[model samples]
Target chain A: MNLFKIVTKNMRQRALATTLTGISVALAVALTVAIVHIKRGMQQRFEQSTLGYEMVIGAKGSPLQLVLNTVFNLDISPGNIPWTLVEKLQADRRVKAAVPFSVGDNYRGFRIIGTTGAFGETFGYKLAEGRWFTCSIEALRDAFKEALEHSQERIAKEKGDAPAKPAAHHHNAAEAVIGATVAQETGLRVGQKFIAAHGVEVSPNAEEHTDNPWTITGILAPTGTAVDRGLYINLDSFYHIEGHEVRDAPKDNDPDPGQVSAIALKLRSPIHAFPIYREINDGEEAMAAFPAVEVRKLFAIVGNIDRILLAQAILIGLVAGVAIAVSIYNSMSERRREIAILRALGARRGTIFAIVVLEAVAICAAGAVAGVAGGHLIVMVANAALRHVSGFTVAPLTMEVAELWVVAGSVALGALAGIGPAWRAYRTEVAENLAPTS
Target chain B: MNDAVLSLREVRKSYREADGNRLDVIQVGQFELAAGDQIALVGSSGSGKSTLLNLIAGILLPDAGVVCVNGTDITQLPEAKRDRFRAGNIGYVFQSFNLLQGFTALENVRLGQMFGNGTGDAVELLKKVDLAHRLHHKPRALSVGEQQRVAIARALVNAPALVLADEPTGSLDAANGTAVLELLRQVCTEGRHTLLMVTHDPAVMRHFERVVRLEELR
Candidate 1:
């Protein structure tokens, strides 16, 4: 009786064509939704992981490589800069804080970093169990001083022989702080001991540092960042490990005494970041690079891949639109008698036109809704797998403004596809179609 | 002249053959039907009886003529307005029954009422046509006579002043055809609607008070 009921009945009569067209639209929409979700999620994760650090100073090399090694714990570091440079940066008035990192080791494929406790605080890491390591040389020196004072007092009180001299340096190579992912994957609990290999990847020939096995003194809580996949130990302990120190270096060629992979710097004011970056790159000691700038460059390279995927999604959408057009137009031939009946019943040409177009819109709207839901389901599954493999999480069921535009665009395409069929319906001749069949 | 419910003046309609020859389908100098008139238009195949009915219903436009229904000249109006006028004042019943295939008998009648001046109840009209028991039955489920009855109910649901039936009994067997013709004549008489029907069957001519032969009119 009504236009909607009539349209529904007509579609039901040709269920196969309707379903096929709907599925085509759904496929296009799903691809578009998945692409937009992944691209945005990647950008958000990269930007969030780089927060709180203004610049990274490392050995002269690729800035992107330096950032990837220092921030994301991927790829090898360029080389080690002098530990003295970290101290100098810390002493500078323009630098609010400087955290040193020493890399090139892994525990079962998870990177092991030698850093100070300040590094944990700089990256906002919270301990899940036990306490931070006695990792810094200064902390060890203070502990040694306290132990010496206790022995002297005991000697005086007992009227015993003179107290023995305290050792100048004591390396706590036995202690380690493991990240959440490292603890989960390795099944290493507090007080458990493990040996770290000398390289970033696990290979049969990679040498293990068995001379100084490490105990898990603390475990970090999950932060949804690269930190969740790292193992932290004392800088001094890293140096004391066998085969860690370079034996022979020309004094003139390598002026710095100790080595560190990179220094994470926090500026006194954000405005001072570029000035200090220029000063370090211009200096002979090390090179300075901004993490944000390097991440942008990385995305520019990744953008090419994104463009190809987006084009493929758009092509699928266009093909789906054409499928809708062909399906509707084909059905119009069979519907001529029905259209003429409506015309005889006093339906204007515009009414017939509107009915056809509305049918197309209805089909597309249903497909769009299903596609969006399906896209998020895929994202949820992918997020679970990515979190397990890489310790990175992308939230599922997140909708962006661009996705809304995609839905709108699909509806417009459906309407556009309906135009040809609707025009044919509008031009139906009542007299010819209603001629009596002999 | 004012009492005539349907009138035509100098009506002419033609068609072009495939070989570029012109053919005149219907040509009538003048025609008139009084209020409540029940007339039959008789002709053989290709004699343009159906074409004349279509022109009178405003479903087709004449090449040069005026078709006036219910005291208004439909030929002077634009296509859109003509459709509205036909919907409000003229109803049609085709030989094939032309009942929308998927719609129930009640829905088909209701559809006719939707475009009209909205004056009559569809259920009441179906009951008048003795199809109350088959209100929810679709055209395919009904017998041929029952389907024609539903079509009659649909054509009268708008209470139009003029009803055009193009070979209304042409598709039925002898028994069903006679029954449908009798029912149609009784319904139109009771409603005081002017009836114009086209048919080639001589048996169907007896129910009408006046019979117009297309051969003589041309």
Candidate 2:
């Protein structure tokens, strides 16, 4: 019989053990594949979530927190700097574009960012269904009307939204431009008006801007990550909705005056980020945060988790290797007579050795087949689920160069497993084995 | 002296006991067989008769001696060369029939042929064995007499210059054993190939042209 037929027949005879070994290899392979997919997914998300500004300028706080508040719409502001200081930074020769953002308002948990046209361009944000506002008055009407539409649509959709429109408008009254997730989640439509609800209950008077309604004018495109949760507006619209101008109106009509939360600065080069950030934050009241640096730090914080999972994969792979070894070791006992027969039939020791070792290779190949199949199945299921839930598609477990190394490594392990018993068979004495004791 | 197909010169072999003393299996001895010769080695238990056959087949190395098969000094050749030489010129039939379990009788015979024999026409060899009908039958399905016949066909398929049969009919009944032994003698006679058979049955030895009896190992 051919070597492949012999090995497969043997495995079929011991059906249960072979299946158990195959499944063991499969489980190990599945775990490795899943962990690798997650790591890659997180890396891409982390990078996308930090795109836009070359440098973020704020009050003296953690650079990471400054980036989180301004770029990611998470945590608190880096504390505010005076409006005049932002004006000076905006005037700098290296600054190509600048947009100020004042955070702290939330419409059903999506952060409201009061910004300018430069902010939309800075984040590469484009209207999936509507247009961007250019003038200050247009920005104000856009923010106010959009917020109302967002809240109203969320309630009407009965999925995610604000309660009935609030009564008063304050610092939180600025309009809301729905993120792609918010629009899809709440089924919001353009022109709907809604309130910007506050989430920080610790500050009961913190976001009392219900009187200023924001109308939903546009929805942003999905960027595959957290940006799908962002809300946009303009700085002057926020102050107008907050009644800051209404209460202290001058005798004559004039432009609304107030300080923005912070200004996002874009530099000429990514390499210029650190130097410009250091210069901006050095001895000044305002601090500058680099998105790239903060993302790198975040990656460093969670780097060991991936390594731990990888270590577990290696451990399971080793265990599967041992199971393969035991299979060969046990088979040697059953095949002793057959081996002796072959020897008597003129098979040299080397031929016997080759056949036994080939059996081991055949078994490992079975394990590899099982592992790759099981691993692919898990990746496919994960991809389908992620696509449905987050609208972000996960790439299937690719047969990378590294995986080839793993297969070669397992084959080497299989060889080691068979060497002991196959060598014993090779050295057997044909005369003694075939001698008639009776 | 006339082109001895198989020869042994001063062959010796021994086994070591747990107590460090030696139990000699076979002392130094010499023997030779010519083409068309039918010889039987008859002995009691543990008489080293099988060891001599193994030496001739190049399956075992004598402690000290020379073995030549088909005029080539097999004992002096390296292990690989010796195996090649054996596969090229020597064929063996064991008492157990020694057919691979998973393969059919014909496949077993073909396997033997592949290792340097059976390079010629296969249909001719099947016709000679008279096993043409039973070619597809596995060893387990075949009766003891039938299995022995298959083994004989395998040994002769390569058309080796010499054939070694160890108790080829040991497991058969009277009629079957006689039929198998007669088949072996008739095939070797027709092909002019040398036959060296080791057996315990005196009745079977009568068919041999020469009979060598060993009282003890030497």
Task: Return the top candidate by DockQ.
Answer: 1
**What is the TM-score of each predicted model, taking all chains together?**
0.86, 0.77
Candidate 2, residues A250-344, lDDT tens digits: the string is: 22232323355678887666676667767876766687777878888877776788789878987887797678668767866666776766666
Report the number of backbone clashes for model 1: 0
lDDT per residue, candidate 1, A37-146, as tens digits?
Answer: 87788777777778887899999989998998998888889987877788789999998899998897888888899888788787678899988887665653443243
Off by over 4 Å in 1: A107-109, A125-134, A139-198, A202-224, A233-243, A246-257, A384-391, A436-438, B1-3, B18-21, B102-107, B113-138, B215-218
| Top-TM-score candidate index | 1
**Per-residue lDDT of A204 in model 1:** 86
lDDT tens string, model 1, B79-146?
A: 88887888888889999999888889998888888767567889988998888899999888999999
lDDT of 2 by residue, B51-74 (tens): 778888888888898788878888
* lDDT score for residue A340 of model 2: 68
Question: Highest lDDT among the candidates is held by which one?
Answer: 1
